[model samples]
Target: MSMKDDLNKLNETVKQYRDELRVQMHLAQQDVRDEWDDLDEYWDKFRQKLDDIRHDADGVGQDTRETAYNLGEELKAGYERIRKRLK
Candidate 1:
């Protein structure tokens, strides 16, 4: 698939996981909550990057595209970590 398709799929998955975790965050430890806060900030930035890329695909550079994809992957992993901890 193309980078746009890949990022969109990743975005959806990450959002779903994030929503699930948010519901269970009350059970999370302080450190986990802190990490969540950091990831939440990152998520906003990543979403903005994704939006920029989607709106102006030709204007965005390869490096920026890669960075956004990498950030999404990291966010996915971070969400999974918190999910495991909550369980």
Candidate 2:
């Protein structure tokens, strides 16, 4: 093949790869968003439970506190992971 024809073929190959990469990245972003949405739902439930536990000072026990603390930590870590992925 002529040099010009080879250059054209190379450019077309690069364009195809770029388009594929764009689609893959778009799908990945959507997956991440869906995961974050699911996590947010759970995070809200955990927050409510934590608030209830805090409010019930007399009923609050070590186990309850520990559970709440652990859940909060998990949510925090999840948020950090999503944030890092977005960046």
Candidate 3:
């Protein structure tokens, strides 16, 4: 093919790749948002449990509190990671 024809082909290929990438990115964003929604639900449950424990301080065991704390930290880290990825 002539140089001009080759350049045109390359340009077309790049455009196709870019279009595909955009669609993939959009699908990925939706998946991430769905994951975040699920995490938010879990977070709400965790918060409710923490509040219950706080209200009944003496009834809650040390192990339970520690587990909750660790889980909360993990959730926070996961959330931060997702936020960073979105950015």
- Residue 66, model 3: Cα distance from true site in angstroms: 1.7
Q: Which 10-residue window of candidate 3 scores lowest in summed lDDT?
A: 2-11
lDDT of 2 by residue, 1-87 (tens): 743343344334433433444444454577776766766675666666556764785687766655655555565566556655755
- Give stretches of model 1 more than 4 Å off: none
Q: Name the 10 consecutive residues with the lowest summed lDDT in model 1.
A: 62-71
Pairs with backbone N, CA or C atoms under 3 Å apart (clashes), candidate 2: none
Candidate 2 vs 3: which has more lDDT: 2
Candidate closest to the true structure, highest lDDT:
1
lDDT of 1 by residue, 2-79 (tens): 888898899999999999999999988899999999999989989999988989999999888898999999999999
Which tens-of-lDDT digit does each residue in 30-82 have in candidate 3?
Answer: 77767666666756655665666668777877766665555465555556556
Q: What is the lDDT of residue 73 in candidate 1?
A: 97
> Global lDDT for candidate 2?
0.56
Ten-residue stretch with the least lDDT total in model 2 = 2-11
- Model 2 collision count: 0
Q: Which predicted model would earn the best TM-score?
A: 1
Query: How accurate locally, in lDDT, is each candidate?
Result: 0.93, 0.56, 0.56
